[model samples]
Target: MNDVSMPYETHGRTGQKSRTRTALVTAAREMVANGQTPTVDRAASAASVSRATAYRYFPNHASLLAAAHPETGTQSLLGDDPPDDPAARLDIVIRAFTTLIVETETQQRTMLRLSLEAQDAAPDHAPLPLRQGRAIGWITEALEPLRGQLTDEGLHRLVLAIRSATGIEALVWLTDMAGLSRDEAVDLMRGSARALLASALPV
Candidate 1:
């Protein structure tokens, strides 16, 4: 019978490629966290993979960046069944957003840098706005009962405020720039969100 193990060489190559792709992503994230630009060669070396292997998965800078930053899609901390009460739902979303920011610090920073770089290279490539929309959609749905209380402009302002308060920009400022510990920063964000909601929403 023909030997199935004969293709060991091909299997080894596939395994190496998978390892290289993982390494490249890890290295790229680290570079962004350290405030350094992540180039293909640097990422390859950091991942312990050859430059050629890195190119095989990510043909160009844009492709590599896009691969590194993926949206969480429909998986949100606030489950599909939103709370029946508007205020309770808002609380859930605010807490979820705050937790997400604190927990995904490294990934958040990498995404922020990737977004800015992509915007500079090609304004149309920016994905931050789309991501922001997803967050706002959650907030709006939760606050549907208070729809009449908030004007369109007011709602927009609220979304912008929340986004600004919970993203990488805030994380970096609180942690690196302002010298707050991760826990402290997260607590501060949670408080800020609560304060905003209390002030913005009607009684």
Candidate 2:
């Protein structure tokens, strides 16, 4: 059997496509980091790529920004050898999630602002990245051990409640409206997540 039958040309072509996609996304991310809500054309200009090429890659500002979103793919907040206790597991998840928010605070705020504008411009607009279920999936995974104890409805409700207390929305309110420092906000989220777990599971 020929293990290399896939051919170098195919590999090279795939690699090129990956690089092009990365370039477009990187341009959008850098523009977002600078506090500019960029159109697909602007990202193309920043990437030194043609607008047509960029459009082929991202299609619209929403899709472009979605790919560029800082929290777009944060799948696992858990560590190697994660604790089996749901409360402890959730604490670890909250701590890691809050750390991400602090590090990408600027980018998160930009995405949030754009999400608001999109919501206003069209009530049925495409979902912004942060509003997608990435965090929910991760949190659910962390709390998987509780499945036996919780009905599906109960588990879902608990996830939503914890999500409401954590994540970027909570950070914005805690820091901007409540005037807590970044560290203070993180601590508060961790505490809230642990408390929620305890109440829900009652071990």
Candidate 3:
């Protein structure tokens, strides 16, 4: 809610305060990774920084948790050696994406929950990460070879289908309710992505 679209700037902070803030964010991330929603006080205690200073850094739980979300800043899921084939490229992307989701499952789930709750609370104006379109860009890049093959609208639809079939929400349901092992969930996620791609661009 706090104008997250604005560039994340850690300006106007002295050395000590900046250190304190870093410590607090690190503590919050650790708690989030361990399946706990952290509070300013808890993070402060964890960091050995005073609660007052922690409050100064993150005034609300949402702000702290949002900050805890991993900032990949990556444009493509492909590794240094990427394939030229569209399906193979997308498969690489899905594999890397699912691996990261499994590694940071707890934090990803927390971010998804916050985004959902925020949207449910107010249908209009969903903020950071969710509305940011980072995954969309990555998926689009992965399917870049299909750009000329399919119409723009068709390609967009395919991208959305892949996005819907993967991510934290699917990860949560796959592991939590569906009772799939981590490897099983990743396998299904990759399979769904490839199936969707094949449907769009048949062999």
Candidate 4:
């Protein structure tokens, strides 16, 4: 299972090869943080490694970019033993989601740029990694306890509202435009999530 988590090319000589793979991934992440959509060749150059070695780890642009996205591995925000109360579940998920965005803001920003660029090039296509609506799934799961309380459409709308407020787009506005610190931005997002959830519940 651990080997499945490792890059396939590093399986034989794990030590040195793993370090090299890490270097390439770290270099790719650094480029992404700096607002560059890096290629395998570019990452190799940045890492001071040979292009051939980098290609072994990431064969194509999409694979390299995917590796650079920090949230690619996260399928859920709800921890084990999640509460049944919708509000509590939402609060827990929102905190975790907001922390992830704030910590990986740079990588998030890079993917946002790429997603927008892809949109411009091809409208109506499924969005790139950052815009793939993974947060929607997480939010929906958090609000699952509300299913009997609200209509399907109402619950979906509430989930969308919470997701809109808590995602990277809102974070960019809160921190970059509104000049709030990251922690302040995260707090506002959490408040927004709670407010949206409350507004959808019984009066």
lDDT of 2 at 40: 89
Q: Which candidate has the top score in TM-score?
A: 2
lDDT of 3 by residue, 42-125 (tens): 999999988776777777666776666764435567888888899899988888888888877878876677677768887775
Residue 77, candidate 1: alpha-carbon lDDT: 49
Clashing pairs in 3: none
Q: Tell me how many residue pairs clash in candidate 2.
A: 0
- In angstroms, how far off is 21's CA in candidate 1? 12
- lDDT for each residue of candidate 4 in 1-203, tens digit (9 for 90 to 100): 11123356646887778778778778888898888888889899989999877877777666677667777668878988998999999999999999888888888888888878767887886555445577889999999988888999999999888888988899999988999998898889999989888888998
- Tens digits of per-residue lDDT for model 1 on 1-203? 11111232246576665555667777876776676667788888888888886777666675555445433343354677777776677778777776776666777776677667667877776454324455667676666766678898887787678667865688799999999998888788767866787799777
Relative to the true structure, candidate 4 reaches a TM of 0.78
| Better candidate number, 1 or 3, judged by lDDT | 3
Error of 4 at 89 (Å): 0.7
Clashing pairs in 2: none
Model 4 alpha-carbon drift over 4 Å, by segment: 1-24, 44-60
* lDDT of all predictions: 0.67, 0.80, 0.77, 0.82
RMSD (Å) per prediction: 8.1, 5.2, 4.0, 3.5
- Give per-model TM-scores: 0.62, 0.89, 0.77, 0.78
